[model samples]
Target: MSHVGVTLGVMAAIPALVEPTMLRWARQTQGYSVLAAARKIGIDEDKLAACEAGYERLTIEQLRKAAKAYRRSLAVFFLDTPPEGIDTLRDFRRVAGSESGEWSPELHTEFRRAQQQRDWLIDLLESEDTPVPTAWSLPSSEVARLSDAQLASRIRSHLEGLAGSSGPTTSDRYAHSSFWVSTLEDSGVLVLHTSGGGVATQEMRAMSLYFDRVPVIVLNGSDAVRARTFSLVHEYVHLLLHADGLCDMVTTTRATNPNTALEARCNAVAAEVLMPAAAVRAATESLRGRPVDEWTYERIASAAVRFGTSAEALLLRLVNLGLASRSLYEQRREDFQRAYVEQERSAATGGDFYRTKARDIGKGYVRRVAGAHRRKVIDSFTAATYLDVKVGQITRLAEAAGFASASGR
Candidate 1:
C-alpha cells in the first residue's frame, strides 16, 4: 500500500475515550501517584499525566494496561463519572492516638475484596438453596446497658455453646487462635485473614463488616497468633454490637471517654472473655499481696501464656481490676509495644504455600467449597474459583483444610 493509505489506516485505530476524572480517581484511590501508575502500566509518565489532564487519550491496549495496573475493571472507565465508592465503613483508627492516620491502598483493596467475598459466599449458598446463617446481635442500647463483665460472660457462654464438644473449657488447645476462628465460623461469622501486604498490624489489627447475616471479620495474618486471638474477640464484639469498621485495636482510652468508648468496650469484652475475672484472680493469687512494682515480669508472662494473651494485655487488665498499678503498666507499655512492632514487621515471610493460602481462605470456607465439589454440586473450575486457587490445587487445599481429598489422596 501507498504511504498515504498506510497512514490513513493507522489514524483509524480506536482510542479508549475514558473520562479524565475517572482515570485520576482510580489512580489516586489505589494510592498510586501518576509516575508510579505510569511505570506499572508501562507507559510514559508524561503521557499518563496528559491523559489524566484530558489532553490525551489512551489507545484501547493502553487503557487495558491501565485497568490491570489500577486493579479496576475496564468497564469502570466508560462511566460518565467515577461511581460512588466503598467509603461507608467508619474510620475508628483516629481515636487510636498517634497511630491514627490514613490507611494504605492495600488496606482499601483488601476491604473491597472482603466485601466481594461476602457477596460471593451469599450467592454461592443461595444457588444451592442453602440459607445463609444470620449472626446473632445485641441491640446497641442493650449492649450499652450491660457491664463489661456481664457482657463478656454472656458472649463467652454463647461461644461455648456454639463450640459444643470442642469448647475452650474442655480442650487444652482452645488457647489457639484457630480455635477462636473456628468457633466464630460455627456461629455463622465469616472470618478471614489478610495476606499482610499493606495492612500493617499497627495500622489495623482487624476489621469487621457487620451484615445482619454472615458478618465478616478480617484479621491481620501477620500478627502473632495470640495477638490475633485478642483481635478476633475484639472484632467479634464489634460485630455483636453491629458496629463495623477498621480497627487498630488500640483501646488506650477508658470506656468513659466518649470518643473511643466503643473501642474500649470491645477491648474490655475481649480481655474478660479470654482472661475471666475469676480465672485471672485465681491465677495471680500468690502475687496478690505484692506491690504492683514488685510483680515480676516472669509472673505476668506466665499468667498471660495460660490465657493465650500478651503480657501487656494481662498487665493492663490487672490495672483495671486493681491487681496491678497503672503507673507500673504505663512504665512497661512502650517496651511491649516496641517488641510487638518488631514481631509484626518480621511476620508471614516464608511458609508452605498451600497452608498459607488455606489460612487466608478460612478453613470453614475451604471445607464448604470442598464439600460442594465432593458432592458434584460444583465442578473443578467452580471449586477453584470459590477457593481462590487453581483447579489442580483444590485437593491440596482440602488437605490443608484438614481432610483427605474426595479421591482419598
Candidate 2:
C-alpha cells in the first residue's frame, strides 16, 4: 500500500473505546432499531450489533456518526453508564390497535428540547427570585371543577386585551396564532413553535409540559396557521389541567376512551375559548330557521375566518351548540379533511434568520434571555446557546425581540 493509504487504514482501525452498553442504551433511548441506527451511522447492521455487543469496535469517525444519529455528545459515550432519562410525557395519539411505545426520534428530541428549555427557564427565574406567573394562580383542581364555559369565560376575561373593542381579530391568520403565543408567554407560559427538522403534523400537532413555575407549550409549526391557533388554545387547556402529554389533537371526542376523553375536554375548552357560545350564536342568528344544509362550505370558511380557526373546528362547534346537525358536521368535516389532505405541505420558508429564530424560540424567551445578558446575568455565549443562535447573532436576536443589541457587554 502507498504510505498515505497505510496511514489512513491505521487511523480507521482506531477504536472509540466507548462502553458497549452505552452504545446500545443510546440507540434504544432514541427509539432507533439496530438496523435503523446502522443506516443512520452509514455502517452495516452486523457491525453495529457487534460494536454494541463488545464483540467489535467502531472507529472514532463511526462513533461520532453514531453520536450525531443518537443526538448525544461524543463525550457521553465515555461515561460509566448511560444517563437515566424517563419518558415523562403520556402518549395520547390514537393508534389503530394496541399501544406502541415507538415514537419518532424527532419526537424524542423535541421532548428533551422542551425539558431543557423548561429547566433553563426555571434556573433563570430562580436567579432573579421571580415568582411564578399569576396566570397559574388558579390551581388545577379548581380548573378541573369548573365547566368548560366557566373556564372559557375566565380565560376570555384574562386575555381580553387580545380582542380589543370590536371582537376576535380579522383574518390575519398568522398574527392570530402569534398573538395567542405572545399573550400566553406574558402569562408566564413559554410558547415555542417547532422549526424545520421538527416532528411532522401527523405525529404530533402539539404538546404541553406542565410545571408550577413556568409551563410550556410547543406547537407543530408545519400545521396550518388556523389549525395551530386551535392547537395553541388546546394545549393551554392541557396546562390548566396540569396534564402533560404528547398529543395528536386528532379531534376524536368519544368519551369511552380515556385518552380521547382528556383530548375531548381540551378540545371542548378550546372551542369555547376561541368560539364563545354567545359569539357563535350571534354569528349564526341570521340563519336560525334554515336547514343545516344551508351551512355551505363557503359560508363555514367565511365564518371561520373571523375567528382565525379551521372551518372543521367551527363546524364542530356549531354541532355542539345545536346550531347545526351532527350529520351535516360529519359530511362537511369529511370535505374539510380531504382538502387538508390535498393541501400542499408547507415548505420551510428561507428568510431573514433573526425573525425566524425569534418566532421559533418565542419573543418572550428571547427578551428574557436578552435582558439577562444585558444585566450580565448570562454571557454572550450563554445567551446565544439559550436562543439557539451564534454569539455573533446575539445582537440581532435582541433587536428582533425589540431590545437593543447587548452584545457590547
Model 1 C-alpha lDDT versus the unseen true structure: 0.79
Look at candidate 1 and give me any clashing residue pairs. Answer: none
Error of 2 at 139 (Å): 1.3
lDDT of 2 at 353: 76
What's model 2's lDDT at 288?
56
How many residue-pair clashes does candidate 2 contain? 0
Candidate 1: list runs displaced more than 4 Å: 1-13, 85-87, 95-100, 139-141, 165-175, 196-198, 254-259, 291-294, 337-350, 403-409
Q: After superposition, how far is residue 187 of candidate 2 from its true place, in Å?
A: 1.7
Q: Model 1, range 155-192, lDDT digits (tens) per residue?
A: 88877777774335322323567778888886788888
Instruction: Report lDDT (Cα) of residue 48, candidate 2.
Output: 97
Report the CA-based lDDT of candidate 2 relative to the real structure. 0.79
Question: Model 2, residue 202: displacement in angstroms?
Answer: 1.0
**Cα TM-score of candidate 1:** 0.87
What is candidate 2's lDDT per residue for 11-35, written digit by digit as tens?
8768989899999988987889999
Question: For model 2, where is the 10-residue window of minimal lDDT?
Answer: 340-349
